[model samples]
Target: MANFIKPYNDDPFVGHLATPITSSAVTRAILQNLPAYRFGLTPLLRGLEIGLAHGYFFIGPFAKLGPLRDSDVGLLAGFMSTIGFIVILTIGLTIYGAATFGQEKSSGNPNDLQTKKAWDEFKGGFFVGACGSAGFAFICLSSIPTFTV
Candidate 1:
């Protein structure tokens, strides 16, 4: 049987966290065969998954907090909040990445190169995921007419 859970030693992000596991054998097998996973794009894929879920589920609650509770206005607020979140996250991650990058460069470890590459991919994936999901949500939500002619 193929291992569904990634080994902790192989996953730098697994610190203090449970190893990732597919819920079923079929899902694990299918995902394992995907080019994205093969190419180490799991971070990007995970980011997209997280962003899409956040956009769908949190937007409504955010919209509720908008002034007058108008649908269009609420949606606009939600969209803006999404943008703001992306910006903030980007800045924070950039700082974290920079610090890690410097440490990895100085560590003199043979595996640092691979770690750096993975970190770069993770950052790119996170940015793309946030932007893509936010853009999609904006397009979908903005199409709803606030007032009928």
Candidate 2:
């Protein structure tokens, strides 16, 4: 009993998670563990790269326009609508990330952002952040006619 128990306890999360592992399963596991840059470096780089792209997209308009027209309701609304998307999305992601990393997003506290084991989930969040910026910018650009003379 102890002999089998030791092997079973090796990795509580993964060991015996599946059994009767097949030839293709072995091949797939080998492929996933392959030391290729595509699987390893790319995900890391892509997450940071997409984050940078989103940050630039967020900052570009502010630097050019000096500041958004907060006093003017129309421009303010549009501008807020534009940036609000980014802010909320970023905050939401931070919340989720913190949760995954076992931390809190509130309390005005300094954060230690730890990447979770779920790379796929992180990638999805990164993509959503980028796409939200793009979509909000597109909406703001398209709605300009009504705001202008």
Candidate 3:
């Protein structure tokens, strides 16, 4: 029978407070899997690459325009970080769904349960990258001096 439920190992800490850690683990598992890795790479790399690109393009232009307020910086960083995460989750989930469909189609057994597991892991991977990015952005943005001039 297909296990429709997403497994999170029944750990309270993992279930409540540490989604990023779970996400990273899922991402790692997906990456380690030879077949799924190829499909997963697009979004994984995209999050990092686009985040860097956005920072480079927007920061300099904004700086050149004038001195930015801390709020402005926070808003910009948060927006970009959020967008990057959105991209990661959207793309990752799409790929995961497609892969799951493919797996189901290829198998003769209609009761295959691994498909659900794969989906859960992919969700975790996406969450992991998104959380990591958000945390990093928060820390970096928070450190900026809120100089009230």
Candidate 4:
């Protein structure tokens, strides 16, 4: 019949072949949509902040004592340890933040659960980072014992 004959363009086989979407493509799409600052630099910045504070705290004591031993190596190690802890903390916090706060679609919708979750994550991250950094510093100090103060 004349009605049964479809146009060539309407034929399924004649259409353009689309690229199949894979799991990797979907993951890339999600990552691309996320805010770079929140997902990437926030953690690193937080770690750097902690490291700077630790360095400042040591400055006074280091200045008071005259260097006789391997202060340079010890200091470098201590700083590196602090930086490492910060990296760990930042990663933990970023993952937590992404899971907890990232689901909210609108700033206008104020939900108490979101607030509580954020608070809990913040406290947890602080403790984890602090404990890790302290433990690392203790190990480094015990091993090196460079500062007289």
Off by over 4 Å in 4: 1-72, 109-149
Show the lowest summed lDDT stretch of 10 residues, model 2.
104-113
**Candidate-wise lDDT, in order:** 0.60, 0.50, 0.49, 0.47
Q: In candidate 1, what are the lDDT values of residues 27-127, reduced to their tens digit? A: 77888765445444455564565555554554555566756366546677877776777778767877877776755643343223235555555566666
- Which ranges of candidate 3 are over 4 A from the true structure? 1-88, 91-116, 146-149
Give residue 3's lDDT in candidate 3 (0 to 100): 43
Worst 10 residues of 3 by lDDT: 105-114
Any residue pairs clashing in model 1, and if so which? Answer: none
Q: Which lDDT tens digits does candidate 4 get at residues 21-94?
A: 32247866876654332343333343443444453344224323425235555454554555565556557766
Q: How well is each residue in 11-128 modelled by candidate 2, as lDDT tens digits?
A: 7765563234432467568766643223444443455556546743754464335454344453445445545656676677656766676632333212212344344444554656
What TM-score, computed on C-alpha atoms, does each candidate reach? 0.53, 0.30, 0.34, 0.30
Ranking by TM-score: 1, 3, 4, 2
Assess the local accuracy of residue 107 in candidate 3 as a C-alpha lDDT between 0 and 100: 38
TM-score of 1: 0.53
Candidate 3: what lDDT? 0.49
Our tally of clashes for model 2 stands at: 0
**Local distance difference test, candidate 1:** 0.60
Which regions in candidate 1 have their CA more than 4 angstroms from the true location? 1-43, 56-58, 103-114, 144-149
Better of 2 and 3 by lDDT: 2
